[model samples]
Target: MHDATVIGNRLRTLRKWRGLTLVELAGMAGMSKTHLSDIERGLKALDRRSYVASLSTALRVSEADLVGGPHLTQDPVQAGPHSTVPQMRIALQTNTLTEPATDRAREVGILTAEVKQLEDVFARCDYVTLGSRLPGIIDELHFHAARPQNEAAQRDSLTALVEACMYATFRMKDLGYGDLAHQAATRAEEAARLLGDPVALGKAAYCRIQTMPREAGWDRKLTAARRAADTLQPHVRSAEGTAVLGMLILTSALAAAVAYRLDDARDGLAEARDLANYIDDDPCRNWSAFSITNVGAWGVALAVESGESGGAVLEKARIVDESLLLGRPSRRATFLADVGRGLAREQKTAKGALGWMLRAEGVAPQRIRNSPQVREAVAVMIQRSKVAASGRELRGLAARMGIPH
Candidate 1:
């Protein structure tokens, strides 16, 4: 699949056609200019999946273009679906970059409403609608942050920018656009630094962890998670503080599971449980709804990730009421996907596993489509469905999800 010389030549051709110098392209791609130049000159290989993805996103091309597909003569933004990159570009093109000095109150109120709208859109899993609106929201935040006002105004503007960038990171990662997500994470981190708010910084760190490429190594992810938890733990008495703490700890448990440190994973989850207990079931932080049940949901995912199976995983999942999970459809969907995984991996309850996977898709089709573990379960369940009547429904669900029959 790797043709290094061909890939390098395509990279050069695309860069020239787009009128981007190596430095500009490298900045957009989150790589060094020298490294980008080396790849274009065929002195280095473009063999890594992450690098190729970032290069394609930077050049406003597709992975297919970099990997020997036909050249894309149209605007790159026109190539993808309603993803964040295209939308952000549109936002930049349309919105005024300079903010007027006199309408500070009006602008702040507008931003507050927009932030709530964005958060509600995410909560409802209305991704397409959210994508459509994000460009304008992001553009407005940028304009607000670009101008200097009072400390309160600047902090509010920067926090809004951080939130918008974080949303972009989360949405892009959920859609499997790791490279694009990385750019958003960088913006979130930069904005968080500008705000100088500990909570925003911690949230930005969480976004960085969420957007991290899988090849970055699970151990590195675990380290980042621990650092975020440590940084945010000092403010654990407040609800938002506890929510951020819980988020970091939840991420740590998952990262530890992926790193194969089962004990560390459990310890992280235990801390998450404590933080969750501090919250009052409300969505404490913008998108992070930290609650005891949410911690239990993570426990379900961790158990599956750690290769726990059979009744062990099922019993653990049972401890958290399904109703508690229902408030956040995305989290509930993920939990059910893990249930499917645990069952399928153990090979003890094929029919039940298929049912759980189907239920997850019913709750959130995008979550299942984006989840590698859930897809694997579907693949295994497809094989099992070959013999049983219950398998017919699984087959139908797989077909609806575009799984090959």
Candidate 2:
């Protein structure tokens, strides 16, 4: 995508050369001050067509000359008066840095936003460049927290800080920066506790899951997930609230299944199922599309974790097939795990469910691969695949990865 800032800088430079103030330029171009300033900054994501017309009109440069310049895209433009401001390239943000808000739905929004931004970075920014700013992000989160604001605004900023922390933590993990991620998650919990909201506390609890040993950890994670999931129950009269509660319960169920707490997982899933039914039946429900499918998706994961029973596999398949995950990466990961679990049941793959495991990995790298949701599947896949059979790659992946074995 073409950076508006560079084009804006070009326009600013040309106007200055003509000795035009923004006021003078606005008159010349028959545009407003805001419009002129907007054109000068790269905040706008203009395409080729808009680029030509706007730059030609505002910069007073010939379209041919504008197009001919080397600074046409997000690709680096040479340093000069008409160049782009260098955007910050930060290192992988650890998961802890990207904390969920003290509210349920906002966490989804923040994570979703980060996932989208990551896609852009992968497409345009150099991996090495984006990999250098982890420490700065952590610093910024605390700095932002210390600034003064009204109570409501302060809460909102805290939410943003938590989201940033979570992103940093995940980025740190994906880039193999465990110590940074661990530190960020630790800090995130402290911040979330300050907020004292169930949703935030839950996220704070789950954030530490990655730091603990597998057997001893999931239990605490499940406890935290359950508390968070159940936190919205008091407000569940509304269909949307019910759906949100379902999601929290669903999270707890996942942890329970991982910890081999089949009874607990079953209870949560059953409750989630009832909530999903109400959300579907109610017309006034304010649930988003993701909110609706979140529970069913969890059910599928839980089914797999619980070693899918006689009809549970088919039910999950049918349910997931009807899910909102038309092309969703997280959904695909869930589906892949379900498939892998099914395969495991039938002695389907001698290579140990390679298809599902590989697809989960494939679907995630561009989507939510670095997310907390994807790890359980990966752990199950690796363990089942027997990749740890004294292989060089297995030891390397386990030892190098900060994930508890």
Candidate 3:
């Protein structure tokens, strides 16, 4: 077994290297900041089964590697030093990083190279092509979390990964791989506890709970989503964290709205709107689309689901239609779902609902092979679609996908 002091110190070092404050990292890890402080300081020992496994997922270290080794503190950038491979071997006792890749693993390896290259540009720079890569970027995060150089790198990657997971999960619904997406989101939440940033924690927690409703854990989904909502504060303390709050608002509120909790959904949207305003006024940054586009889309979605206001839905539709024209499959799926929800709210003939819902159904298969978010949202509407009280062929289409009523 690895020495407890060494493990703790390695964890602490990784956390620090990622630039996460103790409170942030602890919060991301789901441990109290004080307790994390004790562990890092050597006053307490890690509980291997529960704490260590989660820590491993969050840290990307193996059970064996976590116990003994020189431990990789190297940056997770794919270009890890070739020369250090030997030193990495000497210290690690068991060299996990140098392991060769399998066929599937090799694909993921290339994906990681591309993702890191893009993410570096995402973090330190800007480019017109960035939006084009968002989908692949999220996919890579799922793959990378399983192979981080250390807990800190995992923590560092958690925020972006969660953003991708939540975005895909909500709008897509059927991400085809529900289990993988759920695990990815769960790991992101585990890492959020280490981030110690309450705002980040709130965001990660939101994604963690969202997979619950559709994955046979509705009870946990409802409970955890509510809990995560409770954790987001109404302050713009950290510009980035606050911007992320907008994402939390949009995703968590959408979950609440879908769960049929009108009160929670409404309250969550109100807070989210306020956060959006704050995020808008701050200096422009990469998350501008996050705060503006997604925030607006989510608010409209919550309103359509929980409110009877046709004007509100129409208004939101107008805005989303104007700003969202990239044909990004996830965004298209999200917008189409909201439009269907709006028509459903108006009691417009099922035709209106059918029109948009069909477009969404078509969009889902075309954009992604497995999207749970779109499936769930579409399924809900399919439940509501009365075939617009007409269209025989359309009803057939709707029936096949499981529309209710």
Each candidate: what lDDT? 0.69, 0.48, 0.49
Write the residue-wise lDDT of candidate 3 on 197-252 in tens digits.
68767766765665552323233455665566556655447666666666655665
lDDT for 43 (candidate 1): 41
True-structure RMSD, every candidate: 10.8, 23.8, 18.9
Worst 10 residues of 1 by lDDT: 70-79
Sort every candidate by lDDT, greatest first: 1, 3, 2
Q: In model 3, how large is the Cα lDDT of residue 204?
A: 66
Q: What is the Cα-based lDDT of residue 145 in candidate 3? A: 53
Tens digit per residue, CA lDDT, model 1, 32-105: 99978866764444544456656777777766666552111122222222344576555534443354222333
| lDDT-better candidate, 2 vs 3 | 3
RMSD of 2: 23.8
Q: Which parts of model 3 have CA positions greater than 4 angstroms off?
A: 1-113, 116-173, 193-200, 213-223, 229-239, 255-261, 281-289, 307-316, 319-321, 325-328, 344-348, 358-405
Stretches > 4 Å off in candidate 2: 1-138, 149-153, 169-182, 209-212, 215-217, 230-232, 235-244, 277-292, 309-315, 349-362, 366-405
* lDDT for residue 302 in candidate 2, whole number 0-100: 73
